[model samples]
Target: MVENKHVLEISSVTTSDRGVYTCKASNRFGADICQAEMAIIDKPHFIKVVKGTNTVLQCEVAGTGPFEISWYKDKKQIRSSKKYRLTSQKAVISLEVSSFNSADVGEYECVIANEVGKCMCSATYILKDWQTPLIS
Candidate 1:
């Protein structure tokens, strides 16, 4: 026996840690190598937009892809339609709601997932409409 002992450890991990890692060892008559991939799954975040206007709800996300991103309204899943335009490029996802009206005032959530995991975040669209006060 040539001593039975080996150790391989990763002290800390960050976004930069998401990549392929390889280890290789060799002897005069033999060689060995191994590789693995590390993927990161991050949650979506809310974006600022104006209400009562043609606004695009932006969901800025960061994670490994190809990802399946979806929008939700009042806890209900929303599908792409003429009025609701959905687009995604890189890590940014958008839901275009044309002529945002009073009926559109509600909570909306953005969810994204890959083969690894799923993450989501929500934002509330509120409109402060004032009514006239009357006195007798």
Candidate 2:
């Protein structure tokens, strides 16, 4: 008689880790097999924006739906209003600011979650001067 066992583990999964996986066991008598698809819960990342201007801060994410996205500034939750507009399209989420001012400079975080898991990413917004380039 013979016995065998196996296990697979993945840490810090990303979009590149998504794919189909198969496991098979065979012996002199016969063979048994099993398969499953690995899906990743990707973390959000900010997209590049124009400097020293009223620009939209966008982040892209990829994973299984339905996904819920939330925005925060300096650890405080942000809501859509005249000064800020939030939009989500497929895997992309964005926050549009009406104007760039000193008050807007802070840490901005994007949180994305689904039934499987949740992940978040943040960027620091800094303004040197109106003429100076924007940094985030």
Candidate 3:
């Protein structure tokens, strides 16, 4: 017989709570039983990138679920270009650039999102404008 109806009500659920759960219900003549299993997983870490000759943004995460990745420049979504390349795997993801130029100077963000949650990391590279060279 079920002592209480509310058995799975809690404030927060975590990975530790993953296991088999049983609920027993009984009547005057017979009894019925139910069982279930649960699993809790954590979201992935943010992607990070640095400014250099060939800049690449890397994102790391875990789990077998749908994931979405995007690159942003100056808070705007960056469409596929000749200089930008994107690659991904189960735990590793990256955005590679063939070369860096003055136009690439700005805040760059890498976003990784799933049905459960999302995480983001960003880096900024500023370039100084130069004037024409003077002839002697």
Candidate 4:
């Protein structure tokens, strides 16, 4: 006697993967199908940098690539330049915003995407002003 069977495993699944998945089997007579669904885990951590100094905003990602990484300041997309530097190594991507100032103190968003899917995350950076207050 012989039996045919198979198995599928998913690692580090997110909310998007929670939907129902269908598996189909066929024989000479007819066909059979099965389905399964599951929930998953998820967040952003805070980052701090000194005022008027260079700062790096990094995002951590997992799974397969080629991946696209992007940085945003206050809902606006940011690009790489002399003042802004972008770097990527494996699962980590970073954006360096040069000369961190009052204008740069705000919410930042890091968007990571691959052929499989896309994930968006946000974190806030607090600025520590180095300028001393003038005496009256």
Q: lDDT for model 4, on a 0 to 1 scale? A: 0.65
The list of candidate 4 runs beyond 4 A from truth reads: 1-54, 130-136
Q: How would you encode candidate 3's per-residue C-alpha lDDT over 95-117 as one tens digit per residue?
A: 77666666676777878777778
lDDT of 2: 0.74
What TM-score, over all chains together, does every model reach? 0.67, 0.60, 0.66, 0.54
lDDT of each: 0.68, 0.74, 0.68, 0.65
**For residue 33, what is the lDDT in candidate 4?**
99
Candidate 3 has which clashing residue pairs, if any?
Answer: none
Best by TM-score: 1
User: Who is ahead in lDDT, 2 or 3?
Assistant: 2
lDDT value, residue 59 of candidate 3: 62
Off by over 4 Å in 1: 18-54, 130-136
The candidate 3 region of ten consecutive residues with least summed lDDT is 127-136
Q: Which has the higher lDDT value, candidate number 3 or candidate number 4? A: 3
Model 1: residue 43 alpha-carbon error in angstroms: 6.7
> What is the per-residue lDDT of model 1 for residues 1-119, given as tens digits with 9 covering 90 to 100?
69755566767766777888887878899999888887765533334422223356666666657788888988988888876888887766787776666767778877887777787
Q: Which ten residues in a row have the lowest lDDT in candidate 1?
A: 127-136
Candidate 3: C-alpha RMSD after superposition: 6.7
The alpha-carbon lDDT assigned to residue 134 of candidate 2 equals: 59
Clashing pairs in 4: none
